[model samples]
Target: MIEPMADPKLSHQLDDKTDDIKKAADVVAAHLKKLEQTQKDAKDDIGSAQWRLKESQIYNITKHFRQIMNQYNEECVAHRDRCKKAIKREFEISGIRRTDDEIEDMIENGFPGTFSFS
Candidate 1:
C-alpha cells in the first residue's frame, strides 16, 4: 500500500547531505592550509640554498686567488733582483747611472728615438 508523502524523511535526507558537504569542505580547507604552508617552507628553503651557493662561490674564488698569490709570492723577489742586476749591468757598460726616478720616467715616457738595441 502506498503511504501518504511524509516531509520529515526528505528533511532528514537533506540534512544528512548538508552534513556530508560540510565535512568535505572542512577536509578541503585543511588541505589548502597545508599546501600554503608547504609553499612557504619551500620558498624559505630556496632562500637558504641561494645563500649557501653564494658562500661556496665566494670560498672557491678566494681559494683560487690565494693559490695564484702563493705561486707569485715565491718568485717575486728573485724576479725583481734579476731585473735590477740586468739594469745595473747595462748602465755600467754605458758608463752611466741614472737616478731611479729618471729610469722610471724613461720607461713611462718611452726611450728617445736615438735609443737602439745595437
Candidate 2:
C-alpha cells in the first residue's frame, strides 16, 4: 500500500505564516538600529553643548578679570597724581623753586634719598 501525502493547503498556510514572522523580525531589527543611532547622536549633541557652556564661562571670567585690572590701574594712576601734587607743594613751601618738568622728572626718576629699584 502507498503512503498518503501531506495536505498542500496546510503547508502553504505554514509558509505564509513563516514569511510574515520573518518580515516582522526584519522591521524590529531596523527599528532597533535607528534607535541606537539616535542615542549616539543625542550623546554627541550633549557633549557639544557642554563644551560651548565651558567656553562661555571661561570668556566671562576673563572679561571680569580684565575689568577688575582696568579699575585697579585707574585707581593707581589717581593715587600717583595725588602723590606728585603733594610732593610739589612740599618743595614750594621749602624754598625749592623747581619747574613742573623738573618735579615730574624727579618723581618718576626717584629723588636723591628715595629708595627706587626700577
Candidate 3:
C-alpha cells in the first residue's frame, strides 16, 4: 500500500490563518460580553411603571438591543461560513458547515459570550 503525500509547505499558512481567526473570535467574544453586561444592568434598573420616562427609555434601549442582536445573528452566520471555508482550505475537511446549535455552543463554551448559555 502507498501512503499519500502531505504539503508541509502549507502548514505555516494554516497556522497563520488559525491565529487570525482566533484573534477575531476573541474580539467578538469580548464585545458579546460587554453587550450582555449592559443588558443585565438595564434589566436590574427596571423599576415599577411609575417612572414613565425611565420606562420609556428602557423600552427604546431594549428595542435597539434587539436590532443589534439581529445583526449579531447574521454575523454569527457569516463567521461560521468563514470558519468553514478557512478550515476546509487549511485542513481539507468535507461538508464543513457548522450547525447553528454547535456554533452557539462553541461560542458559549470555549470562546465566550454575554448571555448565560443556559
Candidate 4:
C-alpha cells in the first residue's frame, strides 16, 4: 500500500515548481498573442518601407523568444526528470513499487491520496 509522505512540505515544494512552469507558459502565450496582433497590424501596411523594417524587427524578436522558450522548456524537462528520480527513490526506500505512469500522475497532479503520516 502507498503511504503518505514523511514530510508534507516536499509536496508543497513540488507544487510550487509546477506552478512556476505554468506561469512561464502563460507569459509565453501572452507574448505570442501580442506578436500575432502586431503581425496582423503590419499586414495593412505591407508595401511601406517602415512596415518592412518593423516586420524584420518582429521576425528577429520572435526568433529570439523562440530560442529562449526552447531553453526554458529544456530546463523544465530536466527538472521534471530529476523530480521523478527523487520520487522513485523515495518510494523504493519506503518499500512501495509504483509504475512510471503512476509516479508521473502523482507528480503532475500532486499526490492523489492523503499526505499525512499515519
Candidate 5:
C-alpha cells in the first residue's frame, strides 16, 4: 500500500528530502565502519598479546578495548546528530509543524521506523 503525501506541494520535495536522508545515513554508516575497524584493531591486539594476567599488564591489555569502546560511543552520538539534522530538514521541507517535544521524540527514535519522516 502506497501512502500518498496529503499535501501535493510537498510531493515535489520528496526527492530532495530522500537525498538528505540518504546522505545522513551514509555519514552514520561511515562512522560505524570506523568504529568496526577500531574494534577489530583492539581484538587483534588482544589476540597477539602474551598475557600472564599481571596487574599492570592487564591494564595495558584492556586499554585498547576501552579506547575502541569510547570511539564507538562517539560514533553513535555522531550518528544520532546526523539523524536529527536529516529529520529536521525533512520536517521543514514537508511543512510539517511539530512541537519541540514531538521532534525530540523523532530524533531519539532515529531512522527507518514509525517515528521517521523519510
Candidate 6:
C-alpha cells in the first residue's frame, strides 16, 4: 500500500491554467450578458408592434425589429460559443467534468459572468 506523492510543480501549473481559463470565461460571460440583454430588448420592441395603426408602418416596423432580433440572435450564439469554448478549455486544463447543460446553465444564470465563484 504505497501512497503517491503530490507534485508541487504540477499543482502550480494547474492553478495557473485554471486562473487563465477563469479569466477567459469571465470575458465570455460578460459578452453573453450583453447579448442576452440586447436579445431581450429586441423581443420587447417586436412585442410592442401591436400599437401600429397602418399596415405599412406595421410591416416596416416588424421587418426592422426582425432584422435587429436576428442580429442579436446571431451575436448571442457567437457569445455562447465563446463561453462554451472557454469552459471546455477549463475542463481540459483543470480536469473538471461538466455537462453541456451545466455549462449553459452557468452562462444563463450569470455564474461566470462576474467571476464570482463564492
User: Which candidate leads in TM-score?
Assistant: 4
**Which digits, one per residue and each the tens of the lDDT, describe model 4 over residues 14-49?**
557768877987787688779768777766688789
Q: Residue-wise lDDT of candidate 3 within 33-96, one digit each (tens)?
A: 6755665567645564645565565567657755766775576567656643443343334434
- In TM-score terms, candidate 4 sits at 0.62
Distance from true position, residue 103, model 3, in Å? Answer: 29
lDDT of 2 by residue, 1-118 (tens): 0111134454345447647855765675566556545545665555687656755665565566557656755764675576566656667667667788876786565443222212
lDDT of 2: 0.55
Q: Candidate 6 lDDT, tens digit per residue, 10-111?
A: 434544764785576567556655655555566545545543233345456556655765675576567568767776666667666888998788655444
Q: Which prediction has the highest lDDT against the true structure?
A: 4
Error of 3 at 2 (Å): 19
Give me the runs in candidate 2 sitting further than 4 Å from their true place: 1-47, 112-118
Model 4, CA-based lDDT: 0.69
Question: How far does residue 51 in candidate 6 sit from its true spot (Å)?
Answer: 16
* 35-107 per-residue lDDT for model 1 (tens digits): 5455456655556876567556655655665565566545544544444445545666877877777655643
lDDT of 3: 0.51
Query: Model 6 clash pairs?
Result: none
RMSD of 5: 12.6
Model 3 misplaced stretches (Cα beyond 4 Å): 1-5, 44-118
- The per-prediction tally of clashing pairs is 0, 0, 0, 0, 0, 0
CA deviation > 4 Å runs, candidate 5 = 1-53, 108-118
User: Clashing pairs in model 4?
Assistant: none
List TM-scores for all candidates, in order. 0.36, 0.49, 0.34, 0.62, 0.45, 0.44
Q: Taking the tens digit of each residue's C-alpha lDDT, what string does model 5 give over 1-118?
A: 0232334345446546656756775675566557555655665455443422333444554565557556755765675565556566677778777766776685444334323454
